[model samples]
Target: MAPAQAQMGTIFLLFIGISKAINDVQMLKPIDLSIEVLILGEVLLSWKPNVNPELESYVVKYNVLIKTPMKEEQYTTQNNSTKRMVALHKGLCAQVCAVYYEREKETARSQWAKAKLQAPPGANGTSITNLSCVIYTEASNNTAMDCSWLPGEEAPEDTQYFLFYRYNIHLEECQNYSRSHDGKRHSSCQFAKTDIQITEDTIVVIYVNGSSKHSTIKPFDQLFNPSTIERINPPMNITVALKQESLCAEWMKPVSVWPSPCFTYEINVSDWVTGSTKQLTVKDNSICLLTNSQSRYSVQVRAAGSDLCGNSKQWSAWSKPVFSDKPQKASVLLLLFLVYGALAGIMLLSAVLCTRFQLHRRLFPQVPAPRNPFKDLLSYNEAPTEGALEVISDIDDPEPNE
Candidate 1:
């Protein structure tokens, strides 16, 4: 009986030691760990499942503890929900702890992860509420002649977000300016003088910073001065008409007048035959009338003023010669009449001779009878019937008898 009792006691002691060892293994199991931190104005902390075969749920604890050279501060808060880990703290230091669990068993808790949170080096703290321009130009004749913006400390990595200009004719100068708002690289800008005709009063200038949201505004001066004329093209047009006593001339304006302003025009008229010239100046109109009636004349117009930059517009194409009608004599008429009469007489005589010849041919159409042959053979006193045969026979018989 004593030996059986001693054997039971030894078995009991061994069983208790084995149960403690299993509990110790469960507590000391190595767990996986993952941590993430983000810094804005405040530090943001997040975590993922640290176990293989991911846990169904997790419990997260976060705290900000700082150990500076001068002092220390602890900021710890328990977030005991069974969800993924996410936390935010606006303090100097942060600590995150997560406990993962499966559906059937409680997994081990991960080791604490610590982080320090502080403001960025150059945090200004004040947001740019608004950005705009103060002064701008909007006139038609007077342009936004020149423009500029405030310079920056450094050149921006990207130049697209630099300053720009806007011109609006309807609204006030202050309302026309707009700035960029995208968070791109920043750059500085300068202005260049331009040649334009602005007739309105207000102009606006816009200033843009690196982040685009930060911008300012400024007003521009109103330009009302007269525009400068450069040069004319193709010159002008001039024409002349002859009246009874005087030569009337007209002209057209220069076609290529840049920066147009009010102008005074003058014309120089000269007579080619008489060797005399006259000058006539007219107001802001292009046309001019000259009244020096002559047989031959030439006229030209020139525009001159202090507001013009270059020489006066050249004179127009020359005017044509003008002349009056003179009376013609009657001697040429008499000579023409005499020549016509002589031609008529020669034609009449030819017609008369031709008519007489036709009449004679019609009256004597028959051939004339042959002349009497025996009558022409005898002399004027000889008888027409004479027998010479008897006399010839008597003369022959007498010669035979001898």
Candidate 2:
């Protein structure tokens, strides 16, 4: 009886072993393969697990084959994860299979479950093209800078964008931005304003990523320096003063992503009434005009990065205009002449009056007085000179009769 029982047990064990071998040989392939494209140039893959319980027991891992326009690569994961993430590109394809191992060697693999890569819904359906950055500094705020870009072609109307930057050993996302006048979204973002370091060896690189309800998910990267895309701010606080008979313009250097000393400036002076303009360039912030004949003048200041900083060709937008008033040269000369003529006329009149007074004094001084005839007649009668007394008596008698 003991030997019979032992033989039976042996037969049972062999049958069990045969059953496992059959299951291993017939391992079920994964099904329902799917792929999702993600930002950061990655793809997510998922599949349905095999349904056979006996086959599932022998399954140790999943093997994925990825194909791109450039090359193909295979990845094996020990974990029975239904999903995996891998690098992705355009025209990407993936196939997943259940891997069965026996004695540390692949015994069986399910048929390939193929999946075509696709962008997520609401994402830009295409990769970004012509990606670029324009870096600029704001004079009103000296601590931070803004980087801006235009959206690529086929970008959705409701698309929203975000920017990230890497410099030297630091990497971070840009958080702040300048908005439009109506508080609408703008295509720019701001970097760190404080507690950071910038050096010559530091290389600044920017990444722009965008998404929408109907667009693909991808990030566009650009490598650059502050000077490469540097757009200097317009000169600030433009001032005009009348100094030493000339119009003098004084301004402050634009706050810049680069040093203030790395900027060159341009000044434009225009006479609105005369329809003339004068333009000049300078390394400094001040300009002095020897003379301007126009009464109504306007000045605008602009700037560009100097060649020392590797940006010397482009100029910034003109600043808010500064207006000045000065009397025209012809008008000033006429006023001066009129004042001199008035002074000369007053002096000549005084001289003429003095000459006339002197002439009158010399010509009319000590004129003699006329004698009275009645007094002469009375004196002659009293003196009794015969002929004079007779003439006086006759004249006095004739006067009394008349």
Candidate 3:
């Protein structure tokens, strides 16, 4: 009887194992994916878990996919809920599924659960087009965000447009606005020292909307990660000098909140003598080139944040040019001296030879005319030369008689 009871107990344990294996392989689907609005342009996604007590020891993770007209993103996480900040003006859809896995392989996967938010109602062509934005760090450590857009063709003339930004939990309405030249129609907005905290994330959302009596104006929103639209500042205090025969340039980093190490520079050297321009990109603040020192150059430096900080896509405008000392005036002075010295040397030699050899008198000796019989008939105004010829004869030594 004892052996029979023990055998029965073994069979019962085997039956329980078979049932558990069947439960583990059963396909469980997730339920009710939902989006909970947290704030403007932000939402929380939550769903019911596909739990199985039998698979307690195995790890279960959820795969979430968010889709938009422009792009789609997919990620896996162990949590059933996630928080996201995204542009909602165009609307988005999200889907989630449960994945059951062990240390080695996936045992099972649940079906997908989907949720969607419909786009706001408006005419297709009434939404503003060509929206762009730029963010910059001011000298006072303040952050400014500038955005501009073109009016939609279908939009009404008197439609009043407004710009707003959402950062984390804060939403700001742009108070400083710029109007188009044709009319008082708003076309651009600037946020000076935005109360919205500056951060390195894709959470910042810029939204533009308007009210119109003629038709419903569609709103527009875009996500920014801070670096994409940032406009770096030009490098500061560019100084150029010749160092040990090298053309060297130096400058401080741009006026930004980031440290010097977080920036790189682009240096432009324009040789006015050779009429050639050279450009160098360096991670360091100072650069030296073995260039023609005699060639005067105009150098300018521009800076951008590096990957160490948030790298910028746009480079700053070029800084004011700094000129190196004009090729030394000493070279010109030396050339003039050599030319004058040669002329002076010739003059001195001529003077010495003239004093020693009476050169001028030998080359331009006075000639005496033959005594003419007619000279007696000429007037006495002509000076008599009969005795002058004998005095000039001594200037030339008499040659030896042949």
Which is the leading candidate under lDDT?
3
**Clash count in backbone of candidate 3:** 0
Ranking by lDDT: 3, 2, 1
- Tell me the TM-score of each prediction against the true structure: 0.22, 0.44, 0.76
lDDT of each: 0.39, 0.67, 0.81
Off by over 4 Å in 2: 1-125, 139-162, 176-201, 209-216, 257-261, 311-313, 328-402
Which model is ahead, 1 or 2, in terms of lDDT? Answer: 2
TM-score of 1: 0.22
Question: What is candidate 3's lDDT per residue for 350-378, written digit by digit as tens?
Answer: 99999899999998898998988776677
Give all candidate RMSDs, comma-separated: 33.8, 18.5, 10.8
Candidates 1 and 3, the one with greater lDDT = 3
> Which structure among the candidates has the greatest TM-score?
3
* Selected candidate, larger TM-score, 1 vs 3: 3
lDDT, candidate 2, at 390:
41
- Poorest 10 consecutive residues by lDDT, candidate 3: 385-394
TM-score ranking, high to low = 3, 2, 1
For residue 43, model 3's alpha carbon misses the true position, in angstroms, by: 1.3
Model 3, CA-based lDDT: 0.81
The ten-residue window of minimal lDDT in model 2 covers: 194-203
